[model samples]
Target chain A: MTIEQGSYESPIDRSVFDQFAARLAGDLPRPTVVETMTALLRQEIIDGAYGPGTRLPEESLSKRFRISRHSLREAMRLLVHERLLVHETHRGVRVRTVDVHDLGEIFAARRVVECAAVERASDDGAALAVVRAAVREGQQAAEAGVWATVGTADLHFHQAITALAGSSHLDELMRRLLAELRLALHVLADPRRFHEPYLERNDEIATLLERGDRTAAASALRTCLDDAERQLTAAVAA
Target chain B: MTIEQGSYESPIDRSVFDQFAARLAGDLPRPTVVETMTALLRQEIIDGAYGPGTRLPEESLSKRFRISRHSLREAMRLLVHERLLVHETHRGVRVRTVDVHDLGEIFAARRVVECAAVERASDDGAALAVVRAAVREGQQAAEAGVWATVGTADLHFHQAITALAGSSHLDELMRRLLAELRLALHVLADPRRFHEPYLERNDEIATLLERGDRTAAASALRTCLDDAERQLTAAVAA
Candidate 1:
């Protein structure tokens, strides 16, 4: 049966689970099944293959993914906890819907964490080269009009800057925050309007860091964030 | 059957589902069973009621909490998402263990977010009074020698300050970071060491904010965080 028909008709099939398990053979290193499932779901969400508000039919997901009903449900629970998905009784799970307030929160958090990271990066042990490389990649992606690629690169550029703060906990927090923020970007109308200018500003911040001008680098990073926040607010509002 | 015995012998029972449904009757608002279970599990972890690295027997939790195996499993999935718990297929679930580096990362995040918040709280429109009230509560708790109470009050004081930054998102991020930090506190040898000094420092920062001295308040808050970080690091290292 086709995936959709199977989902509606029976929600479960023994062969689907068998295929899912078979598909997993040799595909991933011997990680736990839940981790493998999580990675797959994350990629699907990030790719916009699962549109916001559409229910992720558990049976279909299990059948197609070839994992047990138990493991797929567990993976869905993780996504829900991450705020990437929301689970409703009877209705099942759907990708979370992002609104204007969510955009503001995501960027506000980015400002607090990322700017501090940039300030920290200006010292001797900072990761200047990583930021520069990310910026270069962002510039290339922007020129190619691959807005999603450019957006990911821009996020990486900022993430690398934050990593200079030398706190893995902060890095992990920022990483989760960035993932949520990227979801909003998927629905944004003009992605280029948000990313193109950031490439040059990222370069400028890196240069300031290389010059050991922590204050200037931090100030520039703040301006960069404020500008992006304003643009995102306008885009999401529109 | 007694709770402990039932947990071991026939751990999955029909009444398990009934008890959860009854407790969630009309009064509490966020009505999802899985979410309620998640909150219960999170509280148990934070309170250190569940010993670290102890495998949470699913059947036992399901019976004791009087929740369906499916619902309990879903809640376990959320905790795993929060990194408060980890799940291994053959081994089942265990409370997550935080190391010295993890503790440092948690505090570093708090420092960045809280300092920014303090600066904002000193602004004209910010809610300084609310923060002052929470600080007073922390001081009172400390004076009473209620160290655990003081720890909780201290979290409230900082959360109130972060809320004054006028961003719900930042407040949520701060709350999560604080919860993770609390887990680290569970491992620390002397909880009183940090909370005792923090009560006084909270008052100092509050006074600075009341005077509308944003810079000084931010500076003082940073010092407070630095001191706490040092204590936590020392405890973890020891």
Candidate 2:
């Protein structure tokens, strides 16, 4: 059975997806209605507004989203392709569940990509700019006392780490991995309890890279993610 | 400037995408039209039918694919999102151009994910079976002298390796990265020259994993990818 509807916590609501979407959207021509709808639903799933194993009855969702059944199906189909949602004829559609084991695996995968990024991030000024901006954004969010905003910025920080590797393909892969990460971490009721401690570690990550001490920075990040995964895994277990 | 039309060599005509679609479509339910069309175009890109930097004129593609412009746009949007196609208001849409430097970054990313997958692949019988199947599939394709199919199977072999890690998220990331790898390798007219050498290495990788020698397997795959990258890079340079 599904958890009580009142218990759902969507990461999309915290503007993590929105801030990034707006930043990426940047008036990049006209977006099709289906494209817009798909992003919205994906954000909902990422936010944990819809938990895993919960059936997504299309008839009701289409009505609620005020889109035609055809367009809603397109959006749902896209998410299913992305593995955020899974479809089985017998089961219809349900959000993919992120479990405790998933948390550990995602952390491990993150270490592989993000650590490599830390060690090999481009020294080009443009690449460093992206990483620096992420740190600044996190700092500003912390100063504003918005822990959730800080959480979103923390997601950006890891993304910037991958950017250092300078492969669009790797960057895209990291984007999907991080999305799954936020989804898995959605289980924690108070995200502040999870993200608060990492703020300084993020700065240190940036500082190490800035000074070109990639070896130490990577070691720090590996330790940082290990601790984060352990804490989140414990939280998920509870 | 556009390359000569004679220079365009598409991968889809080999029906690489079609064979898989027909096989998978049986198990899966109705695919949305957009999903179907996206698959078709993506196959074309992978097959080198739509060579890099070639414009995808929407009106023409809609007519060619025998789908509505609306559905065709949806398909194009998906590919663009995948970086197989890029959208521009002025130039319209064109297949993404992968260059020499991209070749290096992709290989670096592959080494991180694939080597890590080697180290962490689960020892359970079923997991090994998946990796075993991919290797066998490649061997069969090579025996039949179907280099393209071998190329496709090679793609699956990496997928199986990642599956050994037992992280669905990692598997998904590997799938995307491998697609880019195939697309990058798409440029070589004689794929045989590129893929023929790797069949034995794949078996070695599977053997190492099956024997539970994760460390040696990881080291072997690292060298495997490094060598493959060098060969591909040299070919691209020519």
Over B1-238, each residue of candidate 2 has an lDDT whose tens digit, in order, gives 2442322332323254345457558866766556677887887787777766777776666655556777887687677767677777556788777667977877777777777667666668898888789888988998999998999998898888877767766677677677777767766778788888889998998888888899999898888888888888887676
Consecutive 10-residue window with the lowest summed lDDT within model 2 chain B: B4-13
Instruction: List runs of model 2 lying over 4 Å from the truth.
Output: A1-105, A119-140, A183-187, A203-220, A233-238, B1-25, B28-30, B48-67, B90-97, B120-136, B184-186, B204-216
Per-residue C-alpha lDDT of model 1 across residues A140-159, encoded as one tens digit per residue = 88778888899899889888
lDDT of 1 by residue, B121-223 (tens): 5364447878888888888887788889989998888898788777666787788878877876776556687678777788888888887887898898888
Any residue pairs clashing in model 1, and if so which? A20-A66, B16-B66
Best of the candidates, lDDT: 2
**Alpha-carbon DockQ of candidate 1:** 0.58
Off by over 4 Å in 1: A1-29, A122-126, A142-145, A188-190, B1-30, B122-126, B187-194
| Steric overlap count per candidate | 2, 11
Local accuracy of candidate 2 as per-residue lDDT tens digits, A95-201 = 78767887777787788778877766667778887888998998899889888789889999889888888776678777877887777676778877778788888
**Predicted complex 1: CAPRI docking category:** medium
Report every candidate's CA lDDT. Answer: 0.75, 0.76
